[model samples]
Target chain A: MNRKGKLWIIILLDIVLGLVFFKALIGASEELSWVYIEKGGIRPDDILSYLDRKDYGTVAIMARSYRIGSKVRDEDEELYLMGEYADLLFYERIFAEDGQTEEAADFEKRRGEIRGVIPEYESVLDDMDQGIEKGLHGVTSDE
Target chain B: MKCPNCGAEVELLDEVCPYCGAVNKESAAHRAEMKHYKERSKNAKEKACGIISENVALIVSSVVLVLLVIGIVAATYVEKNAFMFSHWAARSESLQKSAEYAGILRQYLDSGDYAAFLAFENAHVIPAYEEGYTEFEKISGMATNYVAAMNSIENVVLFGEGAKHYSVDTDISSCQRSIANFFYTYERALTDMEGDPHYGKLLDMKGKMDVALRIYLGLDEEKREEYLESSEGRQKAYLEEVLALE
Candidate 1:
């Protein structure tokens, strides 16, 4: 065709490519912003608050949320696993205390599974076990 | 060139031969036609150039504006669906693992471990709205509130345990607010669980939650029943009285 016709076609193609590129940039930005918000909002103090209260269920949820919501670093892997361990430990106590033998056994089995995977946390697990045991005492107290 | 009149050679644009001085009418007409074509070609080129030069700014501006608008639309679309797109990969993976995940969820539910079910579901980023998982929608909905209520109740119980060292007034007020929030979320959970096929299973879980509340908050069955039956104001009063005892 003519030079002008070819130029118009090139312009159209440029616009099309630009649009695709712009959309991709926006998608990346959106993903980044989301990651930033999630990662930034996860405060160690928040998890500590629940832990101080022996609310292992809430702590587990928070920790899991953080682990899933962001890219977990190698350093944080043990922390996340411990959170899961705490949750399992909490439910084990609850079920055992409530006289639900099968459910409590299930929790114990799950805890054993975790312990098998991360044997390095054995001491930490022991400490959590004792803490939750002591903490649950107050929960079951008549007073 | 040859002249047509006498077969004598002539200049290419010559209208007549000098030797014979013939009219050379054909040569003259050929030159006129060539001139006409040359003028037409030149005029066409000039006209195209003129048009482009005149509208160059307008064309550039129009294209830029179009691209700008498209960029805005693209940005807006991506921003609006960011959450969906971000979860899209995980959701697809969850769909592929639907059967396995469903089994795990079933175990949690069967065991009346709603909190663990929720934690597991969230961690895996399961698509609760998918066809295979729709059954969990109501459960998930109610469990969300149930978990929240449990969290708040735990906080109040912690205050009672002296794990937190806030002032008495602050502790009492905070505990009252926590109790109110627990009731509010519990009512919401009840609404969500209404008409669920797993209503019996859910009620059993709710019973366990109530037991937790009773054990930790000193809320006996009679007190709970009274609180549930009371008006909003009376419920507040009862919570205040309960906290006063604490």
Candidate 2:
């Protein structure tokens, strides 16, 4: 097998521990829920920040609801890919290294726009409300 | 001039059929070219058809070959795991059950209702301590074999989905068996206690057995009864497929 295949087999090995027990028990197919640290060193705080700024309205509010939980959720299997913002930073850095300045700058700018909108605490909610309105209207707000 | 003058029956020298003045040469030449074009079109289509047919055959054969390989791999994986499961079934569950019960007895010895501790006394704890020391002797003896089964060529091939299912069934059952065996020994020791001072230890072992047995046989009563009845060496029937003997 190729390197990628070998890596996948290793992952499959770990997953088997969970699956084997379930299969062995036959009728007792209970699933255990786990909170795992995400790969690529993407801190929970960083993910929460991204979630908050990525959307407005009830969607953003839902993000807020999950933010307080000590556990972090990752949709993708966080196998050994390396990067900050977890794995994404690796790709982003690659973009920068290839001297794709314009693309990288645009990428960082959009990211900054998200960081700009999502305030840290509820104390800034009044200001965020205006930002949300601006976002919904598809206009830039001086506020 | 001759064609214009002739009103009937004209030769080629007269330019056209005298019955009707027409461009005979031009019409005949056009028919020749049209015939040639149609023949060429047919040949071209057949050549293209031949190319497409060849490619289609190549693609279909490749797909069939790939599927065949995958089928072989899948079948091998399943067979190996099934064999392993059967092997696990052949062994009695008692060994594993004992180890686990011992671990629990150790725990309750360390913690739980304090009155529960003195109950173990010299009579109860000593035998369990000795049995716990030796209970995994079978599995321990099989350790090399287990490792071989996990690491050898046959076992290596039995990995992925197959490995997962095989290991899980055997691994959990092994744990249950080890634990159950330990508890049974302890329970047996408790029975030997004919007098007082050991009452508390007896109750401790009893309570621990109640919880552990319920778990070992499964949480439900029906399942527990089924396990107790169908255990290996018993004639009671089992729902699982009978594994092939070595």
lDDT of 1: 0.64
lDDT of 1 by residue, A1-143 (tens): 86567667767766776777687776768564564334334555666665565445456656655423344545555566667676666555556656677887977887788789789868667766665544442245333
Question: What TM-score, computed on C-alpha atoms, does each candidate reach?
Answer: 0.54, 0.20
The top-ranked prediction according to DockQ is: 1
What's the DockQ of model 2? 0.01
lDDT for B63 in candidate 2 is 54
What DockQ does candidate 1 score? 0.12
Candidate-wise lDDT, in order: 0.64, 0.34
> Candidate 1, A132: how far from true, in Å?
3.3
lDDT of 1 by residue, B118-140 (tens): 76687567878987898898778
- Candidate 2 local lDDT, A18-76, one digit each (tens): 35533544322111112112111234454344334332221221232122121234542
Error of 2 at B212 (Å): 4.0
